[model samples]
Target chain A: MQQTRTVELGTGLFVFLGVVALFFLTTQTTGFSGFMGGDAYRVTARFDNIGGLTTRAPVTMAGVTIGRVEAIEFDPERLNARVTMRIDGRYDQIPDDSEASILTAGLLGGQYIGLGAGGSFDNLRDGDEIYLTQSAIVLENLISRFLFQQSQEDQDD
Target chain B: MSVLRELGESFVSFLRILGDMALFLLRLVMYTPRGLLRFRLVVHQVHNTGALSLVIIMISGLFVGMVLALQGFDLLARFNSEDALGTAAALALIKELGPVVTALLFAGRAGTALASEIGLMKATEQLSAMEMMAVDPMRRVVLPRFLGGVIAMPLLVAIFTAIGIFGAWLVGVVMMGVDAGSFWSQMQANVSGDEIFEGVFKSVVFGIAASLIAVYEGYRAWPTAEGVGRATTRTVVLTAVSVLILDYMITAALL
Candidate 1:
């Protein structure tokens, strides 16, 4: 009977540890925690092309993540990608004129939104749209453009 | 004509196997409620399958984590982005390796044991004796073991992931002198709740598949020593392949 009790206790402990691991896995790996209750405000930005800017991409201000991309949709009339972002309530000091640009961490890393502070006292409110936006850089387009320019120069020569 | 007949026979046999497995699964689901009343038996099987399997799971997790850290470190060093090693290792383990490896290991270790044990009991006429005595072996025997296995699997996978992450930390930070703070911070910035949910959900599915296949193979094994051996082997093979296939399907659908 004691042995059976021990086994049961062990099973309980094993399950507890598993739950702890799961807690760590969720909190440590992800930006949000259970305690946060998602206290964030949503904002929107329009870009000519989002490129590989996936949903849930981080929104950073001065290298620190202040929000995340919540959703991405295409606006039919404007022919641009509409990106919805959820900014943490604590970082509400961002100016309305600030620029939101899609950027990669490295040359071949994941995409994120980099916010550049603008020279203004006007604070961005909830559901406010950022007008100044830059889309993701396409390397192929830049390279091809460069090659096309070089070929034109050679033809002139 | 003979070749076509052989093909037809094989196809019929395959359909028969599927039908038998489906009925067996239905019986299992029906008997589960009755089996839950035998709580002591379930506890005993949990002790046997889960508690006993912990050691192997931990060892494998640690090793897999260490190797991931080593490879990640090597690859990241090329671009001077060694600080991202932690993120890479953690993502690989939690998202993919942890649950899949744990399921594969569980199938080989506990799954085989469950199958062989049932097969042996069948061969010895134990199930038939219980039937003759007006007892349902499906409830008294098979269901508890299956339930215990299903309960234990996710826990084992969780432990594997935890140990594997620790192993990565040990190798990357302690052994190789990577900046521990950056490693952890990068991981926090990159990983999300959806990814962890995917991992856990995948393991739960794998657990059900592994446990059900193991018990079903054992219960249906022919009443002979060779049949028991074959059943155990089939339990391992079928569980492994199905786990991989399901993992792919789930990953494709979810990610």
Candidate 2:
């Protein structure tokens, strides 16, 4: 009788668990719509060194993600990496002469593109290239430069 | 001349230690997953290490979350970035601190216990008797604890991380006066499912490594109480070292 009761209880427990697992598995996704919102216009910006420029990396204007990098490609002639970005439609008035610099999110962190909006009335459109682009400040390069300068100073001393 | 000879001796000793460790690891990996006996042993070990450590982890997690929110509130308010508290807390807690610290704590608490238990079993000749009885001690004993630790370790880490975020919310809303809605909403906005999966993946691997080290040391203990004691001490030390090393390697790979 006890064994029969235990078996029944176990069956009930398994059913309960199956229900809970289903709920958790279904609930896990929560839809991926907000992630790919499209009130943004896609544009291209090229850099000599995009160092760690990941897909979906932020494109910033005044440190806000005006858009995100949609894709990255290499240009052998200009010796640069081109970042294609999707920027918010609201920021369409940004001048064509605006500077785009590849910036670090924080010290020793991910790379992002920063747009310095110019006052020129001529604004950019899709497929128009951002001309004034700055490459990422390579950290190792900077450290080596600093060390070389210091050694030069030491030699003079 | 003496220094060179001493260096030579140490190098040979190191190589011998490495060979032993490699052989043990190879044998353990090969011998695992034989049948039900092996499976049960793994589950039992995981229950001991993981289920046992849940209370301590939860309490620690809860308080830490609250304190972080409070501390972060003051700093963020100075820059008017208080709205970002939840995002910051979730990213920092889930991505980095959650798994690493929990693993360290678990290593100290349960890893020590595993080592001591196995060491005692070895010192008493009970392990040898099981071997003589054709019980296959690896399947009957070691594999169970190793597998159990691996399974339980990740689950425990997840529990700790969840409690921590909840704790952070409690402190953020009640103490620091951040709106609860905003906190949760920001968390939803920033903390990706991928990030959470990555953290869990790391913890699972950490669990397997930690359990193997602790259990292996204990299973091979010398036939003395002192030897058993030595094994426990080594387990804690080795587990902690290995956890830190693995954490660095994973972060580098992810980056």
In the order shown, the chain A TM-scores of the predictions are 0.91, 0.74
Give the native contact fraction of candidate 2. Answer: 0.00
Worst 10 residues of 1 chain B by lDDT: B186-195
Tens-place lDDT per residue, model 1, B22-43, is 8887887888887888888888
Predicted model with the maximum TM-score: 1
| Candidate 1 residue-wise lDDT at A31 | 62
Single out the weakest 10-residue window by summed lDDT for candidate 2 chain B.
B35-44
Model 1 has how many clashing residue pairs?
A: 1
- Which CAPRI quality tier does the interface of model 2 achieve? incorrect
Q: After superposition, how far is residue B200 of candidate 1 from its true place, in Å?
A: 0.9
Per-residue C-alpha lDDT of model 1 across residues A94-134, encoded as one tens digit per residue: 99999999999875578999999998899999999999999
Give per-residue CA lDDT, model 2, range B17-104, as digits (tens). Answer: 6688777767777776563444444544555776567678878878877778888888888887676788777767776777888888
